[model samples]
Each structure stands twice: as structure tokens, then as C-alpha cells.
Target: MTDEIKVPDAGTADKAKLTVAILVVIAGVAGYYVLAGRPAWLRWTPVAGSLALAALVLAFSRYGREFRQFVELARVELRKIVWPNRQETGMTTLVVFIFVVVAGIFFWLLDLGLAWATKLITGQGS
Candidate 1:
């Protein structure tokens, strides 16, 4: 039998907290727009404060914990990547450019041949 992982359902409180967190962020954006006539600093303050509080609330939820773990895993995997150097990148780019040029020339010749054949058959053009 294959092992399957089942995610547990979030508790009621966790769901409520997540909802509140989302609402807090939405309220922050709305407040920012609503305070457009006020000073820039004052307009931004609600957005900044509400976002911080939302983040705090989300951090206490199970989904947030899972998200943090996923981010950590992604960071670890990113470190294992072997990025190509400048010379290799340049050579690859040059090869692709050459291939594209050759392909374009080949297609152009094919199109000219087809047009000549069609004109000869239909007697339409010199």
C-alpha cells in the first residue's frame, strides 16, 4: 500500500483567525485609499499597522506554519542549484542565434520555390 499524507482540517479558531487576517489586510488597503486627502504619512500608517497585525495573526495559524516550512524548503533547494556561468550562457545564446538564422534562410528558400512552382502551374506571374 502506498502511503498518503492527509492534511488535517483547520480548527474553527484558526479559520476565524485567517479570515480576520485577510480582512485586516483588505481594510488596510481601503483605509489607504480613503485617507488619500490626508498627509502621506498618515495615509500610510493604517496600511502599515494593519498589515503588521495581519501578519502576526496569520503567523499563529496552522496554514501559516505550513507556509513557513514550505518557504524554508524552497530556500534549501535553491541553494542546491548549479547556475550556468557567463561563458556557457554566451555560447548557448550564440548557438541558438546561429540555428535561428539558418532555419530562417532555409524557410525563405522553400517559400520562393513553392511560389515559382505555383506561378508555373497557374501561369499567373513572371
Candidate 2:
């Protein structure tokens, strides 16, 4: 088997639906800016309406249904996780902080040694 990610192609109708959904959102944004002098609710009408319309249009698309299924599956998987307790979390955080400080010190010493070597070889530190 090849190590390639394979994505299924949505058919022509689904592609058209997705395109219309995108255009609806773009038009809504443009309308919002174009109606900037209007009242807040009036300006927001197109934004809200377009989002709802876009979502409605997207519901008919194949990938949209797949996304819904993915979200549902994710929720099921999310519930199976055993999260770390507060004490375990604190210990892990402390270990990470200690390693970071040690790494920083090691890098700083390496840099200083390299700088000293370069200056000595070139006699440019004066």
C-alpha cells in the first residue's frame, strides 16, 4: 500500500453546492461592508442570512455529510480518553520546566564556547 492520503472527490453537483456556499458567504461579507452606514441589525442581516443559506446549501454536499460523521466519531473517541489528574499534570509540567532550563543553560554554554573560539582564531574580540 502507498503512504499517500486519499481524499474522495465530491461529484459535480456537490462541487457546485460547495461553490455556491462559498459565494454566498463572500457576498454576505461584501454586503455587510457595503451596508456599513445602515443600522447594526440591517448590516448584519445579510451576514446572518448568507451564513444560514450557505449552511443549508452545504448540507446537500457529500463532504459536508462526511464532516458531520467525522465530528460524531470524534465526539465518541473523545469520551474514551483518560485525562491526567491534577497531581500528574503538575509533575509533568515541573519535569518539562526543569528540562527546558537545563537545555537553555547547555545551549548558552555552547554559544559562549563557540564565540570564544571564533574570537581567539580571528583575534577580532578586541
Candidate 3:
């Protein structure tokens, strides 16, 4: 039997994603603290420095190569997408408008029926 080939870059790719996720969370928390009244001198400088460090690490890691490959894959996938032209976009917009109007009419009718039924049941017409 012939040997099976396997994609070997997934581990490095996962590591890169994990690193990015950690960096994002750290940055978010730092921004939140700064917004919640932390001293400016204590906030922005350190956050900026940490972000720079993260960028440097990301650029130097083996995972960075994997990340580049992932980006290339995404680029290819985006190229395969079919976007709507102006006419198709306008038609879709019109269809959405029609659906919204129909839904509004349906809901209005339901509300009126409920109001009438309640009035009849309680002998209090408004």
C-alpha cells in the first residue's frame, strides 16, 4: 500500500491562533481598564509596549510562517466567492422590503384581532 500524506502545518497554525487570541484578550482587558479610569500614564504606554512585543514575537515565530499560509488559503477562498452585482443587489433589497412589509401587515392584523377579541370578552370596547 502507498503511504498516506498528511498536512503537517496544523499544529503550528493552532499555536499561532492561540497566541493571537491571548494577545487580543490581553489588549481588550487593558483597554477596558484604561476606559474604567486607570491613570493614562499607567495605561497606554504599557499597552502599546505589550502590543509591540506581541507583534515582534509573532513575526519571529515558526507559527508566523504557518499564519502566512493560512492567510494565503483565506485569500484563495475569498477569490472563489460570488458577490452580488448592482442589479442583483437592488433586486435582493426589493425582496427584503416586500418581506418586511408583509410581516408588518401580518403582525398588525394579529394585534388588531387580539384587541378585538379582548374587547368582546370583557365588554370594554376601546
Candidate 4:
């Protein structure tokens, strides 16, 4: 009866894509070390290329498609949000700062009172 949004299980193809993506990223790092004697750009090229290839492979998977949809939806939702203006934000921040200062003073007084009471009970401080 719950109105839960269920994510569908990834199919074999999707799983393969995920696996390939991970392998590609790993291969990129391996290549970086393998071409240690090569120029910096040459060593980095395989790493960057592998990452790009992995992203392409992942984008075609079911999860990847879902992720794309999610991102689009997020953008739509972001546009709907009414963000607070600078004046409002400044006022809210000022209020929070005042409350924090008050709380700190209150706690300091409470600590002092407790310490005095403890000393009086123990007859340790004159």
C-alpha cells in the first residue's frame, strides 16, 4: 500500500556495462603506470581515453539512462526552487549568530553555577 518508487533491477546487459566501465577505469590507471618512461601527456592520454570510453559504455546501460533522467528531473526541480535573496540570507544569518552567542553565554553561566555548587558540597573551595 506504500507509495514507494521502486528502482528496477539491472539486467545482465546493464551489469556487463557496469563491469566494463570499472575495468576501463582500472586499465586507464594501469596504463598511466605502464607508460612511466613516456611523456606526461602520453601517460595521461590512456587514462583520460579509458575514462571517456567507460562513460560512453555506461551511458548506454539501463542504470545510465535512469541516471540521465534523474539528472534532467533534478534540473527541472532546481528551477522550481525559490531561493532566498541576499537580504533575507543576511538577516537569517544574523539571527543565528545572535542565538549562538546567547546559548554560549547561558552555557558558561550554567557551568560556573555547577562548579560553585560542586565545590560547596565537597567543602573544597573557600
Best by TM-score: 4
Q: What's the TM-score of every candidate structure?
A: 0.67, 0.70, 0.63, 0.73
RMSD (CA, angstroms), candidate 2: 3.9
Q: Which stretches of candidate 4 lie over 4 Å from their true place?
A: 1-9, 29-52
Cα displacement (angstroms), candidate 4, residue 113, comes to 0.7
Count of steric clashes across candidates, in order:
0, 0, 0, 0
Compared to the true structure, candidate 4 yields what TM-score? 0.73
Q: Model 3, range 1-126, lDDT digits (tens) per residue?
A: 899898666467667765885686598557757666667766676567666767666755666677889999999999999999999999999999999999999999999999999999999994
**How do all the candidates rank in terms of TM-score, highest first?**
4, 2, 1, 3
Error of 3 at 125 (Å): 2.5
Question: Per-model C-alpha lDDT, please?
Answer: 0.95, 0.95, 0.78, 0.96
lDDT top scorer? 4
What count of clashes does model 4 give? 0
lDDT of model 1 at position 122 = 96
Cα lDDT tens digits for candidate 2, 1-126: 779998887799999999999999999999999998999999999999999999999987897798899999999999999999999999999999999999999999999999999999999998
Q: Candidate 1 lDDT (Cα, whole model)?
A: 0.95
lDDT of 3 at 33: 77
Residue range with the least summed lDDT across 10 consecutive positions in model 3: 9-18
Global fold similarity of model 3 (TM-score): 0.63
